[model samples]
Target: MKTFLNKVLVAYFAMTAGLILLNEPGYAYLWAGQGGTDVYIVHSGKDKEEKSALKKALGGDFKVKFYNVDLLALADYSGKQKAIIKLEKARIVIFIKDAPHELLEGSTLNTKVIIFNSGKDALKSKVKTFYLVDKTIAPPGGNTVRASSGSELNKAEAIRNADAVVVDGALDIYKAAALVVAALL
Candidate 1:
């Protein structure tokens, strides 16, 4: 009985230690990326069209990572922290619509932020903002643009406003990617 009890205790301790080690910052990087992520897409994961569009836009050349904000919210405190670290490390972070309020509130990101249909609330935390607006409406200001087509995205006036570019949600995914890529440039 004594030997059996000792073996059980050892197994318990081993599991606990493993859990702690997995939470360490070093381990967190394994999920973030080995070569490093160029772009981090934060979305709800329900919209396949948006995902396909962003992928098509970025092509296969860049290292892109996607994080479902909804899932991140459900994770434990350490898990959320790990995600924040990954987000901060990325060169560019894109916040798709339906992003959880809690995640955005907790993050202190100092990178180029692109807000896609997420709403104006996200713009409050960002330093340099790129807003994506639909092509049907006139751009609210220099910082906004109608992402209807490649031509519209390449316009001098459109590119001149580097502070932020609001893309139209109704526009095609390919066109949206063009606007996003344009914003990246």
Candidate 2:
């Protein structure tokens, strides 16, 4: 009985230690690429069309990749640790759905955090949330463009031309990506 109890205690401690280790940072190698800017998008994999649009929006300047961070095995974790591990290599981290609040936990992470909002309640936190809208399906009056809308490529120049007028709630992936690039630039 004594030996069994000792083994159980050891196992418990080991598991605890492992969990602690999982929370530490430095996991950039996961986003391996040939050498362009790396952008990581943490999505739920349900929005196939939106995902494709986002990729199309990315110019040659970025190596865009999508990751479904909410796996059953890692369900217990807030996913902030996973974000931290790959934070170093990622130029920007975009949250399509299920934004990991853990990323904003403790000290601020060096990578940028973008939360894509599609009529969902915004996070109470002050972090940037890009409003998104589906232009083809929505009722009239609201501004939303189709995913393949051939808007001008010069979002930054347009933004500048607007005299600093900030546009909110992007219509499609192209516009969203343009907004992100503008912010980064």
Model 2 lDDT per residue over 92-150, tens place: 66656433333333424455545453333322213323333343222222233233342
TM-score of each: 0.63, 0.48
TM-score of 1: 0.63
Candidate 1 structure quality by residue, lDDT tens digits, 43-114: 776755686678778877678888887776578877766776678677777776645444656465676666
Q: Sum up the clashes in candidate 2.
A: 1
* Residue pairs with backbone atoms closer than 3 Å in model 1 (clashes): 131-165, 131-166, 131-167, 132-166, 132-167, 133-166, 133-167, 133-168, 134-168
Candidate 2: regions farther than 4 A off? 1-37, 72-79, 98-108, 119-173, 182-185
> Candidate 1: misplaced stretches above 4 Å?
1-33, 123-127, 135-142, 155-160, 166-173, 182-185
Deviation in Å, model 1, residue 89 alpha carbon: 1.2
